[model samples]
Target: MADKEATVYIIDLGHSMGEKHSGRKESNLDFSMRYVWDKISTTVAASRKTWTIGVIGLRTDETNNTLDENGLEGYENISVLQEIGPMSMSALRELRSEIKVSKTKQGDAISAIVLASSMIEDFTKKLKYNRKIILVTDGKGAMDADSLDEVTEKLNDVGIELIVIGVDFDDPDYGFKEEDKPKLKKKNEEILSRLVSQCKKGVYGTMAQAVEELSVPRIKPVRPFKSYDGPLTLGDPETYPNAMSIAVERYFKTKLAHPPSASTVVVNNAPSRSQVDDGDEAIEDNGNGLGAVRQVRAYKVNDPDAPGGKRDVDFDSLERGYEYGRTVVPISDMDESITNLQTKKSFTILGFIPFSSYEPHLSMGEAGVIVAQKFNEKAELALSSLVNALYELQSYAVARYVNKDNQKPFLHLLIPDPKLESEADCLFDVPLPFAEDIRSYQFPPLDKVVTVEGTVLRTHRLLPTPDLSKAMSDLVDAMDLSKFGKDDDGNPTEYAPIDETYNPTIHRINQAIRHRAVHPEEPLQPPAEILLRFSKPPDELVDQVKKQIDILIKKADVKKVPPKVKGKRKRETVKPISGLDVDALLGQAKRTKIDPENAIPEFKQTLGAATEVKAIEEATKQMGDIVCTLIRESFADINYDRAAAHLGVMREELIALEEPDLYNNFLRDLKKKIYQKELDGDRMDMWRGKIIAGGLGLITDQELEVSSITEAEAKKFEK
Candidate 1:
């Protein structure tokens, strides 16, 4: 790949080459010619074999003159300066100098590419690899859909990398005209994006600056054999050999070690042999640490014919002398009686009792005494029960279970002592010693009640205390009496006149009084002293003084005038001299002169010199005018529409190659005529009109015309 050769073909398709931009002597084509020439020359000089170069010009079909053998072709391919070797600077310069600025009729960019592809086809076929065709255009293509696709496919098949360098395609102000807008112009952006995607080496640029940016070389990473030992790693770990083995070895070799300890010992004691009985029962000591014990009790296994009658070794028989011990004691009658007593009645020896008449208590008298002795205690207990019941009621309300058919709030009454229960029963009306007083309470209606624990009668019997009349009367009396004051019509009036004593000062009062009073009829006046000090001068007095001065000046002028005199003499007329002819006098001088032949020659020479001098001066003056006109035109905003119309006229003049040399010379001469400073305004306009008409194929031998041309001529002019 590194040894392969790369060829880049650059084509310029800007409409400025069509001779219609900025009204300047140098068209965009001219600039492109110089620009690409320099670029190719430089690239060739730097790396000749590695790079190949090509160039093409693009314009609309209306202005281009060069054509293919097939008449009225849309595109023209200019010859490229081929094989510009690294050492051939002179050849490059020669090629650059040979570049001619010609107009193209078909500025459509598609035609430009087709022409460029045709021209570079030979060069592309010869190259084995890395072939590239870079288009440097102002984004104007006009080939038909079929031809465009064909040309594009051809370029792609040849493995030619197409790089488009779009230069100011959207800038109509630069060179492009509005009328030249392509039918497929809207797809230009999408086409450029697709081209870049397909070409792999293609790029779009809006300016020379963007072109420079695209030309910058990209930097590639250098693949290294070893990875760096740092916080950030960017190499593949798999490339390193025995990495896991090295890690395991490093781990085991660097670990610490320790030793083990000894075991513990325990002692056992047994009864002596002398303590065993003689014949009553033999004793034995087990070596496995069982103490010496007499076998006074022994049970035999089941034997069918054994002593006393087939004794079966029953598990029940093993307890003949030994009684089975129970961990828990059995209940005696007295204990059972006590348990029954404990179960039948609950003790109040230790439990919470409310100290309030409203809450559960020992007795009403006791509750009353507690409430009197400890008001906060009774109140706290009562409030806690009320709040707890209310909380439960709220829960029932939220659950929507209150006052439901089966769901009812229950009240539990506890009477640890019969005396307390009897007292509770006497206060209430239930059958139990302790009765629920809810019978007297009137509960809220079924729907309204969140939880009904008692009868509705209790709720009705309980009434809220009536408010104190004296307190209500005092509150009413405390309100301001002025707020209730009314007018005679019985309508309430505003509160008593806001204390005027605390109102504004006397100066404010005066201001208010003045604001209410009607405006005076007389004109407002400043103080008399102020008027005297600042009055304007009197107009009548000043006018009177000025009039008197005018009269005095008139009188002085009348006195200074002098009297005029009248008298004159008439002059006589002179007669004409017929003998003294102007030509004869000049000729006699010439005849009487010594050395007449030399004099004649000198006179003729002098006359010729004078005539030449006058002519030169006139020419210089005309050149100065041309220079000024050109300067003004260059700086002036170009009328692109007019210039484009004139370009159409220019395309008509250059028709066939019958006088190819003459046509070329005429074009060169036309360029010089338009560019020269000596051309007058009318003469320049005439020459410019001729050039435009010639280029547009609108000109004829009968004095170059500016009118429209036939379609055939227009098509020919387009090429």
Candidate 2:
């Protein structure tokens, strides 16, 4: 079962909602709140008494003292109808009688959202629960997009999901006149869209969808603990009179929380079979004319890990016990059901396989392959943490069938596989799962899993694929060709470890061959089968990249040469003036004289002369380092705006140093590094924009290509 949940329903009660819509007898306000009540009741039932519901009214009647006694001014006509509480059948039944339509105009949607969020926050304070808000409106109220955006952010910050259900958006056959129907203005739609998008967990739909889906509980997939069921045989056919078969089930021993239970009551008036001891029994007289005695069922309570906690022992059945004179007691029906929550089992290992090898059998196909690969890249740190855990434990893994179906197996490493040396006439085999057999899988909880840092694993979403359409088309064509088959080099299509452990047969054959080398008297081993290896990238693609890199390098070399002076000017030297008498000259020299040229302040020296070549080089190197650091940091943080702004600033600073050519060279170099680093389309586009927006100083206005993938390069790949 899911954790406890809280949902706040913000219903619109404006004059418009009083009119009938979709030819329904109930007013729109009534219909929307009824739908909200249904959702609350359904969620509570589905969650097994774990959900709470709160109701708020938008554009509520200001004069109604029962609903708005506090009369919070500046709240924009929003009023609390029902405080948040656990939903019950009685509460849902009484919801319709409590809500009433208002004559006032619809309240500002943004204000209502803000007010409802505060109510949700106070209710969920110190409580561990999933928070949600359902906004029911006709999408008619005017709202500031910016305010709505802020509300969305705040809700997202507090981990609240906002679901907006717009009524009468598409329905035209309503009881209201055609002119009276809400048009769903573009501005309102846009504001709602932005709100939903920014909320992260937010959802938006029409009234029809809400009616159909709101009552249905959302079922999310959960990871299941797996155990294997197989037959174990013993005794050799020649030595033993008969072979015996034993059933073996393999699973991890897991501690699970006990489900909550309710009290059982027995009345003297009713016939009942009770297990309560006389000493343990407590009786109370009912306040009735008959004065009947009622007995409450007694239960044992203890900490989750306490050994004396309630055990599942059936009083109705018995079996043989380990002791000669003892009998095995059957667990009570109640205890049996609770005991089934926990599990324990055993397994025998076959061999080990890589995660890449295991991924294909997971049933996602081509798209899954790409997603898994991206996940491997994005979640590398988390995977490394898990790998480090194995190193700490000094553990090795082996493949084993995990469940009864036995169609798929996982890498079981924490627990070592049981040895089969004692058993005879036994066969061990691992069957790889076919694509159709692969079901969705979830990782075990962080506490149960062994990881170095206990870092939580994050599942990344599918990234934008701007060029996927073309790539997919090309893939379809390649697959259609009958001649496009296996590689001539006898390589595996997918990555696989080329080691002795990967193939037992190859290891045995090699061992035999080595033995024959030591003892020539023994028969020589047969030739070994060829091992599959990974094929190298096609020469066409490799050469294309190399050519592009070479072109870039040559271009950089050309830009490095300093421009020659057009014409050398002849230098003219002036002779010094004659000196005066020693005494007069000494007096004049002692006097403080400030020339106008000397009084004028001197700015920092610019990089111009050949003598300042070393200085220029140092300055350029420092500036390049700073720029590269900024660019790298911005790209790493995915701050494209910051990166663009920094790039523009660097351009102006570089131009000030009088090294425009050098700056241009740096741009080309940065572009090359970005290309080599494999920045995706979005990053590349931002970099390109930054270079262009910086104007003619930073980069040439000549429209130089920056992505490194020229038209020619793309065409070469097409071939």
lDDT of 1 by residue, 392-415 (tens): 343210110111222332222222
Best-fitting candidate, scored by TM-score: 2
Best by lDDT: 2
Candidate 2 lDDT over 1-719, as tens digits, reads: 45777888888888788877677888777667656655564454443556677887777765322223465544656777777787644454466555777778857777777777787788788678789888898766666555665787789877899888777554333332234544554557667867888887987766765665432223333343323454322343336657433343333333232222323444434223323344556433332112223454544444566687654445335433343457556455576557543322323344344433433333221110000112234233333343344344545335333343423334343222222231211222233445457567886642233347975433322321324434444445433323323454864342232331123344334434333323337685443332211234435445545644444455334355666332211222232356445536467442122222221111112222223445555555554555555556564446555545545554554444444456566766767777676443334554555554434223332323232334454333322
* Backbone atom clashes (below 3 Å) for every candidate: 47, 8
Give residue 416's lDDT in candidate 2 (0 to 100).
22
TM-score between model 2 and native: 0.34
My TM-score estimates for the predictions, one after another, are 0.25, 0.34
Give me the runs in candidate 2 sitting further than 4 Å from their true place.
47-50, 62-72, 125-129, 140-146, 170-190, 214-719
C-alpha lDDT of all candidate models, in order: 0.38, 0.51
